[model samples]
Target: MEWMSWTVPTAAFFIVIGLILLGMTTWELRSPSVLRKGLLPIATTRGDRLFIGLLGSAYLHLLVIGATDWSIWVASALSLVWLLAVMRWG
Candidate 1:
């Protein structure tokens, strides 16, 4: 990680993402998700929703970083909320 020049925030981001993927995989093995309709027009499985949420979060972070001077943690929190919302009721 040091050789990669990984900063704390960058490391933390990847760690959290890795943990989320692990947890989701475990949960899926225990109780597989069925495709279902949510707020998103198309029916989606858990993996689909997860992908969408993460992709959207990336975009959200980029938008905030590019358009504003607020702390990156702000984007992190907002992305977390967005991910949870999509997972729960997308």
Candidate 2:
């Protein structure tokens, strides 16, 4: 079960982040902030939803890579910034 040492913690971390984002999204939907009220609103267009999903996945994967030290944290940070930029600009 050598993989568990890696997979378990990674899975737990992903779950935690997923939960955090879910709660944040829910809160934003019920009463959106300035940013959420703009792009990522509850009634998002299909393209917006796809963009959000892809960015969200990329963000989470980059976070995992950051945690595992397979790469620099800068990449993950930049990925997060990229997600925000796309959500804002798209």
Candidate 3:
């Protein structure tokens, strides 16, 4: 279709998301997660933390881009850190 064009970065993004889903599926099948309270206010399972992390990363990227004159690399780095923190202790 005319709207189906895929840039390299866009394709790579989807590929990464697919891989994350696949890995999460495998992990869940191998070892199930238990809901636990972390630094986050609510109890979360692995998937819950993953969702929060991804959402927070998106917000962090937006904030970095909108609030600073920094480069995209800086925003990407901040987003990565936010993702890691959320995954670890969210």
Per-candidate TM-score against the hidden true structure: 0.89, 0.42, 0.90
Candidate 1 residue spans exceeding 4 A from truth: 1-3
Better of 2 and 3 by lDDT: 3
Report the lDDT of model 2 for residue 45: 41
User: Per-residue lDDT for 9-52 in model 2, tens only?
Assistant: 57876896688568667876887554234444465643454457
How would you order the candidates by TM-score, starting with the best? 3, 1, 2
Model 3 whole-model lDDT (C-alpha atoms): 0.90
In model 1, what is the error at residue 48, expressed in angstroms? 0.7
- Which residue pairs of candidate 2 clash? none
Q: Count the backbone clashes (under 3 Å) in each candidate.
A: 1, 0, 0
lDDT of 3 by residue, 39-59 (tens): 999999999989999888889
lDDT of 2: 0.61
lDDT of each: 0.91, 0.61, 0.90
What TM-score number comes out for model 1?
Answer: 0.89
Cα error, residue 24 of model 3, in Å, equals 0.7
Which 10-residue span in candidate 2 carries the lowest summed lDDT?
Answer: 32-41
> Cα RMSDs of all predictions?
2.2, 6.9, 1.3
